[model samples]
Target: MISFGKILFFPILFLLSLIYRILFFLDRSFKKKRTLPSSVTISVGNFSVGGTGKTPFTLHLSKLLHSNFPSIPILILSRGYGSSGTGTRRVSENSSASEVGDEPLLLKRNLPFAEVYVGSNRYNSYLQFRSESRIPNDQKVFTLLDDGFQHHALNRDLDLVLLDCTKLSKAEFVLPLGLLRESYSSISRANFLIASKFSEEWEDLLSKWVRKYKPSQTLKFKFSPEKLIPLSPGASEVSLKDLSGRSIFGFAGLGNPDSFYSSLKDQNPSQLKTKSYPDHYSYTKEDLTHISEKSSDQDYIICTEKDGVKITSLIEMDQNFSKWFYLRLETVLENESELVNSVRSFL
Candidate 1:
């Protein structure tokens, strides 16, 4: 029998659960079925807000897919998270973070060879890309949807859900109290799980949880620091050792700022200080002035690539602020060949 104390304690949680279920039901019931013509589509997504390394995974997966199946054109689709642009738009080389959002802009900058498009409506976005580009019908195309786990309107061949090891222990309530977009049980919808950034304890917790509600496969991986790349154009790349013993001030406008700071910490800087802004935050002149002021004493002001995308455009890169760099993160997926093969089989 249910205890009265338990019932009273969980009243708010129960109400939130009820609301989530209703929204879930409504989503499933009214979501319009979307279509794409003869293109292999894979979605990389997370259940929580935005901290998971979806962009890196998507980039790595695209490279893998191209390596496995040469001659297939890859198109990246995103909702343009914080961009002000409306409707379906292709991100260009010169597009600002405000025009195409940070992720899409970063994607374009990183993978200049691939096409990146953004639309609130995934189906419409694909259509726009298809119509504007007009690639030959004989060409093989594979589309990767970024942050697409919950964007269920569009059809996808496989869904690669990234489970943040950091969030494994957080309270599982939806929204207002917890970070989950849906209940942990919604993980069953995931075709494959990439358990990322876990400690030994977190790994153990994840393993027990997965055994209780196992999906197809749960692969473990870490987000390793690749290199320190200059945010300024035409600048050469530098190794972690290049900046050793330097005073570094780190800042990020990210869903998980601590994770970025920790990555920066791994490099063993002589002095490390950090500032965090809200996720997808657009920087103002005042904010930049404050960051510059705060970082004045440091030898370098470092940030994640996403923050760099937005920051570099707004702030002039004169001598006063030439000490900035963005840390480029790479997806160091475990069992790379096996994971590729697993995804290939699905393809």
Candidate 2:
């Protein structure tokens, strides 16, 4: 039974949402007329707020494209949600999570060859790139837009939408009430649908859902993390085997903390202790102190690559907390040929 508060609150929310939808429709129509850069833009985003595995998928796609066209210049554009910068800036090896956001920093660390840019306005960033001489036109330039499914202002050549299998069951209500960013009908905008974190059971259910709800023409791809790479301070390389038999304290501030925790639990020593925080959470000294106090006996504190980037500056400030490390995860596409073909067809 619905409570009186919920019954009353829902009606107000419904009315506000109706107003929002009308405004969104008008914004989308007006924004559609803006011209995009000449470079091919491929957006990898999700329908829900979080836990759709967008980062790993973006990394996977970047690696695939880089391998196929070695000389081509690929640029990644992101809004840098938790980053410090007010305007657009190019992400480099020296750029920290505070400077360029966690995801962009993670991308730069993983794919050193690709140029990463962070800005509130992605279209403006693309335009800036087009004017820059550093990024040559002779090199086949492809723009990989991060978290841009709803960013309709910039025209994307290919729109890849990620769906979290777990969230599908709980997608009855719209934002705040439920996780969906838009209505189910928004699937019409995507050129391809990626059922991320797919397992045998989830795959079957996802296929059934797609058959019933999505267009048959929308291509589907399944993806999961291939392996985990360790993220150590001032270290270029560290293997999972190197840290075996050591007691670990795992922590991260990401959309889906469970995935990272699970990955570490599977890979780390059986005696690993785990801790989690809210997405894009900025860590304070007290938080770190609490972690240290809890895991004082532990040998090392492990975290996700994104979280590691944010904590690097903190670690650098104090010498006593330099033992922390991060593990990087990469997406392994289930259907390589189909995924490549879909992208190539768009090109």
Candidate 3:
């Protein structure tokens, strides 16, 4: 049945698209777009507004770059979404989510060896990082621009767009009414298209969609969920086998909580209750107390790596409550050789 919410969604989508177009026009016309030299920048972004596994993909790409080019230092550029900082801030080991946002903090934690900086303005961030004495001026550098599909100002050597295969199966529309940030046609801007979190059944459907939408792009990849890790520091990392038959109270503040919930069910295959908050929701001590009360009966609390980082920080307040764990996923490209070759050819 058509609900009132559904009835209003069409106009809302129209309005969202209108705003998007206006912004696009302003960006092209009024905004003084900045383009850095093409020698060192690569962008990993998504067309959709929510979680398309961009963080994991960005990490994966960073690892790939590090492995492929060991001599060159890799730098990550992020918008620092939900961060309190106004200008460019270099993410350090001690940086909190509130200071530099969750993803940037996560990146810094995961790849402590690399440099991670957050800034709304890509050009300024680049300049700041470049000016650092440690980062040699003459050495060739590679910068990974996170969530930069629409950040057209910064020139990039590679533009990798992530597509959530599950979302593609459903009805597609632009934001306010839908999850998509931009039109499907925007896929053309991508040098590489990564179809993420798809099952075998969805592969045929995704192939068709890619052919229709981005036929020129040949490099394609898959994102695979690898394993689960406990959120608390020094907690034992467990495989999916370890979680089997466990009662899990899954909680997350993610753009795609269902993905985390479903993945948990698959790994555990037992009684699993979930609580979802908005994407980038900062959980307080009170919030944890409430969740703890609700999940008292469950064997363990589980969350995504994104949520794990945030929630783990709050563990100091309630040391007794420590059931939360996170999933560790890796980007598994279908044609790794081709992807590497294409990127290398471009570089």
Candidate 4:
């Protein structure tokens, strides 16, 4: 039975929701339309609040675009949620996660050739790109908007939405109670739907959902991070052979820590100790101290590239903490030909 207080609260929530919808609709109607530059702006985002593999997908798209057109100028625009710097700032070798956000830092590190910028307003970042004349005008510039599905003012050329299988069934309820940031109907605006972490069975269900929603097109993509890339310069290139019979303390502060833990387990096939932190968590000295105290008995303490960046400043204070290493994960399109063909068709 509903409590008396909850009964009164439900009506207030309904009223607020009605007001929010009205404002949302009005905002959509009054929003300024900014035409995308001659450059193709492909936005990779999701309907859910978080943990749909958007960062990895954006990185994968950048790599694919770069490999196909080596000389083409590609720029990645991210909101840089936790970044300290304000306005449009280009990420560089010297940039830290605290300045450019952890995901943007990871992208810059992985795709050093591509230009990466972080700004709250994607349109402003695009304008900044256009204003820069140092880049050749003849070269085709492609902008990959990271987590920009909700930012309708920028007007993206392609809208690719990623959906995690784990949340597919539980996304019925709206935000706070559930993971969806917007109503399911909002997916109708997407040009393509990417059901990440897809299996054969999940693909079938995704197809059904796509048909029901009547999205422009539906494509199945799987998110498999490449075998751990060593973070340190000379980590001896560890492989399955080296991981055998070794005790490791795996830890990460990513959206999907469980996936990272599972990946490590697959490589070792042994019980591994793990510690998980909130997404994009900044590590304090106390946090490192805790990790060191808990992992004293382990052979090595491993973390994700996202977490690894935060530890850099920490290690400088104490040399004994240098032994902690990170595993870098790269996303690859399972079907290269299909992905390439799709982009080519769009171009």
Candidate 5:
């Protein structure tokens, strides 16, 4: 797979990584002050960059909090990756992906009871939500940071970091050099290290970290394929059987797009074709037109639920996308009880 392009490109990537680390060091040292939220804060973040199942895991955590402590209110904080505005904005179920980030809006829709807010200033947003939304004196409120491992501006009661075993199995290095923002040595800083996308092939690597870090808790979770619901409104439930022997056009804008395509292949589709956009990609009309042309012969078009929010919004304006559908991905934390117990003890 080595190419002359990569040979020249890798050196540039290495240089960029060096500069990034230096800036990160300076930023952390200069800030000096970290704010503590009024409510208990549990951050579900990743050491590297995007696509560590932060959104899905946040949703999972919200469910746990709601179920375990029915009286408490939960607040989710997100950076609103693709938002047009820079200031803090409250996300509602009807909010468009353009106003808030796609993930925040998706979170709002799924967790209708929870409050989800997006802004660059997480600490400010956290304070604003707390000041505005008052609760009973006895109820415990929690603030969950979405993809906020490096947000040193605020402190957390528990920091759940994710290590993508799929990508790590190949190589481990810093930033542009590899996927890590820092070295594996810093893995100990996290209260819990969650092994995301866990597989038998990478169990040894996870074991190595467990031995070295000896973190308070090391849990693993798998993102399994859930039911594929039709994107078209009132389209009815569709199952895996629908894709068998049928041509499928799968597309996603995810950190690990290949993983999604692999899942698509497992359905035993007669013909499988996929298109990948960069992480947090904003789909445009031209992009849809291209996909339409590429998948003209495809029987069905499917994407991840994250991508579905944007696609679904756009599809609402057009009636020609009857073949559109989105596959839901759920997380099953292996040591769920233990992890919950650990948090419960802290609370």
Candidate 6:
């Protein structure tokens, strides 16, 4: 999706990208950033449009902060892109995906101890949160700003930017022209560079690219299979052993569906087939019906946590709920100790 072609439209897109760049620089020069009092905000985002393990890394980083700074309350701010809501709303485990958006609700469910809020303007959301909550003098908030690389209005203490190794080379142009939201040169603004969905295949290329930019630090991480979580209520937790030698019909509405299928394949399934949708896609009844027909021969139907949240209601109504499962992925950060120590010195 990021590759360029030798076409006339390419030049036109490049020209428009230049205009976008000018506006970006102007915004950076003129914009005033506001910081929340008693908060150390760490932004986990990327310059590209597609998946680069941003959400998983954000979750991992929040847990890291919680482990190191137990007394601090974790505040996660997100600009809920797909939700129909207008104002900032606190996401809870019981909250519907339609209310707070899928990712925020998922984060809230995963980190019940953390406070997750979604709104278009994160600065205003933080202000609203502060007005409502009673903070102790000794406790400072550890905030995780999700997908906030382009959110220049909010001041952040640390910027953690993720780049997908698989799409790094292809993303040569910015949005409208290519998959990247901004040019890779923008990485210089990042405090920490994260290479997500990493493998040895891109090591030399990644190293050369990193050497070119000389980021403060670079972290490598990959997704690993956690467990098979059944969609049916009161159903016992399924095992990878159960998944082994079984046919899988996997589907995902993610920035990069290939990454999901690749990880799922590692479970050693007998046969693997997949369907991909656009990022943050909302599944409908018609979509589920189509999936059901395609996956009729499959022993199990698998989807990512993101897709699972949106598909639960539809599957719950079906009689074959037992075959529905979501693959929970755990972010495996390499050289984690070094990163932890670096952050500890700051927070």
lDDT of 2 by residue, 168-228 (tens): 5553555545556777678788877877776666666777778776743443445433434
**Cα lDDT computed for each candidate against the true fold:** 0.79, 0.74, 0.77, 0.73, 0.81, 0.82
Evaluated at residue 98, the lDDT of candidate 5 is 85
Clashing pairs in 2: 231-326
Worst 10 residues of 1 by lDDT: 1-10
User: Which candidate has the top score in TM-score?
Assistant: 6
TM-score of each: 0.90, 0.86, 0.91, 0.86, 0.92, 0.94
Worst 10 residues of 6 by lDDT: 1-10
- Backbone clashes counted, model 2: 1
Q: State the lDDT of candidate 6 residue by residue for 89-110, as single tens digits.
A: 9887877777678898888878
Per-residue error (Å), model 3, residue 142: 0.9
> Which ten contiguous residues of candidate 5 have the minimum total lDDT?
29-38
Better of 1 and 4 by lDDT: 1
Q: What digit string (tens of lDDT, one per residue) describes model 4 on residues 1-347?
A: 34465456867755765666677678777899686666777888887766777777777788888889786778998988887889888888778788889888888888887888899877778768767746655455788888878776777778888877655554353443334567768888887777776767676667667777887666666655454555444445455445566777888887767766766776774457999898989888788889889888876678887787777766644347544777656454565566566666645
lDDT of 1 by residue, 217-247 (tens): 7777677788887866666777888767888
TM-score of 5: 0.92
Clash count, one per candidate = 0, 1, 0, 0, 0, 0
Which ranges in model 6 have alpha carbons more than 4 Å from their true place? 1-6, 169-171
